[model samples]
Target: METKAISLGRSLSVPFVQELAKKGLISVPPRYVHTDQDPPIISLDSSSPQVPVIDMQRLLYEDFMDSELQKLDQACREWGFFQLINHEISSKLVGKVKLETEEFFTMPMEEKSKYVQQGDLEGYGNMFVLS
Candidate 1:
């Protein structure tokens, strides 16, 4: 599988978007963008209900497992994403990781390309999809 992915070709680069945006093309390329009018293709509304924020600390309590599991299940079903709080990971390390990510994203695409895995699509770019 890893060999198959590397042979598929290089992952997509966000710097391509940056170049386009510099020319005032802020939107994605046409292949990835949609303007369908038959039915609205996107939603930008924020007044709807919010995504769940799970408390990781509750998972430590065996007695609270059932209720927490119910919340986790509902969150997974409704939003498919959730923010975990109080997981005990170091906040300093988290901040450093985020900072490094920002730095990597801001680096020139040529420099970032150094991270592309020799065997897989795990890199500073998009997935195995050719687009």
Candidate 2:
């Protein structure tokens, strides 16, 4: 009798998302379907206000600590999110990260589906689904 070894990195025969997209189906998947009240996608003005930019450099200073903290608090309280500035991460590194991210997202769905989650986990995912 011959014995065969199972490969951990082997992928499924077909990618589920690619197959669904090829069929022209665009409904939200089970994970994204909200059972609660519908959030407004737009207001009467339909304009997206600018996000607050919180400067980390100022937050680290003694004189600006309280003021920056208050600004951060206000941003969260009002906007639910804010853009972080002067985070100290190098610009070159940030650019590299952005480039790599674009590359990853541009890959063919069939190639990416190789990383689909199994019983426990897989590669990168939005916190909404991965969590």
Candidate 3:
């Protein structure tokens, strides 16, 4: 099979081999050329809207934790979710709980079954089902 060596810059235009040959850039050589079926078209018009920003600087500076709590409560009552800035919780405890929950769920079926509640009991009671 005969192969043609085409120039890089000439490849952008259609009939590149013929044009290159006519320009004395490359010899007229027999080769199998595959044209692009369809180049991919990307649309940048589609995008997600940004989330709303809530400012809590005044509440923090004034030491109005109660007012902030009330605001959070109101937000929960109105909007299901709200961004909080100056809230504090024990990271170690949160990490421990998360790790424990992950480990608990990943345990063997028999082992997980042992932790399952057969009846409603206090301390380890199913809070969701209860009043």
Candidate 4:
């Protein structure tokens, strides 16, 4: 089978929000305001939109496999992300990771800067590449 590389056009350089915040600007600059974009679609119903949920238990069972797979595909297409349930990873481990992530975010900028993205999108930095 022949394979082709997919290109996302180019990497878009965005103004560093930290530097902008340091400037103490009262309002967001007009350049950052996207007036051309349509307003977000909000449902009027009392119930809120939910993050797609995919249960691994259903996926593992023979009878539910096909339907679960379809749901997973739909979730990926419509929501871009989904909350995974019945994943073997314990809640304790999840909590530890969450706490560590929060602590990392709370670290001083000088400390965080040590892990700043150098070239490829692997470390802490703005990921605003325009396609």
Task: Score each candidate by Cα lDDT.
Answer: 0.71, 0.71, 0.51, 0.80
Candidate 2: tens digits of C-alpha lDDT, residues 40-106: 4564554755678899999999999999999899999877889999999999999999999898777
Candidate with best TM-score: 4
C-alpha TM-scores of all predictions? 0.61, 0.53, 0.32, 0.66
- Regions of model 3 farther than 4 Å from truth: 1-63, 75-90, 118-131
List the lowest-lDDT window of 10 residues for candidate 2. Answer: 122-131
What would the per-residue lDDT of candidate 1 be over residues 1-131, giving only the tens digit for each residue? 35432256555544456557668875667766546534332556786466687888787799887888889999998667898888999999999999999998788768877885554555544555455
lDDT per residue (tens digit) for residues 1-131 in model 3: 99875432312112323335556754344332224434333555546322233446646656765776677677777555777553465778778998998887666555765664433332221323311
Q: Which regions of candidate 1 are displaced past 4 Å?
A: 1-16, 34-47, 73-80, 117-121, 128-131
Who is ahead in lDDT, 1 or 4?
Answer: 4
Which predicted model would earn the best lDDT? 4
In the predicted model 1, the residue pairs found to clash are none
Off by over 4 Å in 2: 1-22, 26-31, 35-48, 73-81, 113-123, 126-131
lDDT of 3 at 37: 39
Q: How many backbone clashes does candidate 4 have?
A: 0
